[model samples]
Target: MSRAWMSGRLFGAGVIGAAVVGAGLIVPGSALAATTCAAPPGAPAELTRVQDAEACGSTTDGTGGAWSLGAGGVGFADAVDGATVAAAGFDGGAGAGESRAGRLLAVGYGADSLALGMLDEPGIAVIVTGPASQAFVGDADDPVLCEGNLAAAFNLTAGSGCVLAGAFRYVTPSPL
Candidate 1:
């Protein structure tokens, strides 16, 4: 279970989704039905160790809403209600207080839902639109984001679907 393995899992899921789509199987909008904004259901207990976790759910009409569970350090703003959930840190720590607009994008019915977890420099981000979703992890500056659905584990250092190398942020220590 390595970061590379996690990335591979994400990619594989995406391929499966694509294949299904190509076969004329329409993923119903209901598939993205709303749920309480929280860590994905059946998530591992280790997720509690994450310093922060953010989650959002998409409504039946395609509108999205978000909430958080943890230190309350991370905040979310909907760039496009029901389509995009933007995240920011309260105190402007590493990867905080910045717009990820250019780096993140979701179109059609998939823009309104997302989930994220941060522990120090390592983290994971997920965006859900109906049955289609995407997951990302690693360096906040240059993360490896992919489209698909899968259970993510934040506690494992390099487990499958875990954060990758260079995903950790290296903050400079302040002088005493």
Candidate 2:
């Protein structure tokens, strides 16, 4: 099966979440809830696309949490082809070691079907910026006979603040 993995890095303030679409298939809101975060009005949103399988396998370096993959939900795979196939943490807070005051959401996707294999699996990781971080994961209306995984991470900073992050992985049939 041919697998394609994509990672997105977003920096902001409020809630954080993710969504996945493959081969014209869409997972509804009921299935995958979006991550929410309070992004500054003029803060530049930096999105860097990581290509090359070798680069994806490299360690994700940052100031906050380290990178590691675990089993969650239905179709969660940690080490693929001897490489850690997963997304890294999102830096939201102001400075180094300075955590956010809200939730950080992450999402991952996986699949077994070849037609839908392009979507493959996604890895989600989150860091809380405030007092607490809450997470929710479910399937949308039109459900398919595929495996899915949903993982969440939250960091609670002092002073009535919350931070949240999550990820999703799903498996679908491939085109013959």
Candidate 3:
């Protein structure tokens, strides 16, 4: 794939290109095929930790058709294990003729993890956004620490169609 196409795929814009390459639906050495992200040269190996949790809440908009928010979860990998964690929740309404009239729920790992320079690594930063009222199940093999570029994302839209849940895992370099 070309450098321009690769850049678009990394930022989540090249879905079709990625699908063609990922599913092996395209021929090898094709120019339009999707390309994966590569790590920067001379990047330092670091230790990482994965953290995950879930919560429940509700939202109000004074409309007759009230929307309920519950079962929220968040997961993310951190270079620094055992660091204090914080979470936030949000909700909004459609203006009038918006086709995408729905609610948005998001969770973010504070700047401490990103500030440590871990976020710069390939697949180190993770964000999952989807429909509201989703529940995520925890993985049985959860790791508290990992060595390498830990890639983690959560599907918050599961269970009861309105519950929110999250899971996080970290990757770091293994000790020699």
Backbone collision tally, model 1 = 11
Q: How does model 2 fare in lDDT?
A: 0.21
Answer with 1 or 3, whichever has the higher TM-score: 1
Root-mean-square deviation of each candidate, in angstroms? 16.2, 18.9, 19.9
The runs of at least 3 residues in candidate 2 whose Cα sits more than 4 Å from the true structure, single-residue gaps closed, are: 1-43, 53-101, 107-176
- Model 3's alpha-carbon lDDT is 0.21
lDDT of 2 by residue, 1-176 (tens): 22321121222122233222220132233223222222122322222223221111112112122122111111111222112222322211110111111122223322221111111122222321111222222122112222222222222111111212234332222224
TM-score of 2: 0.18
For candidate 3, report its TM-score. 0.18
What RMSD does model 1 have?
A: 16.2
Residue 3 local lDDT, model 2:
32
Instruction: Kindly list the per-residue Cα lDDT of model 1 for residues 1-176, writing each as its tens digit.
Output: 89987886686556335433532232233223321233222221111123324222221112332232212222333222222233322121111111122121121122222334322333223321222333334334333343334212121222223321223422222224
TM-score of each: 0.21, 0.18, 0.18
The residue-level lDDT of candidate 2 at 77 comes to 15
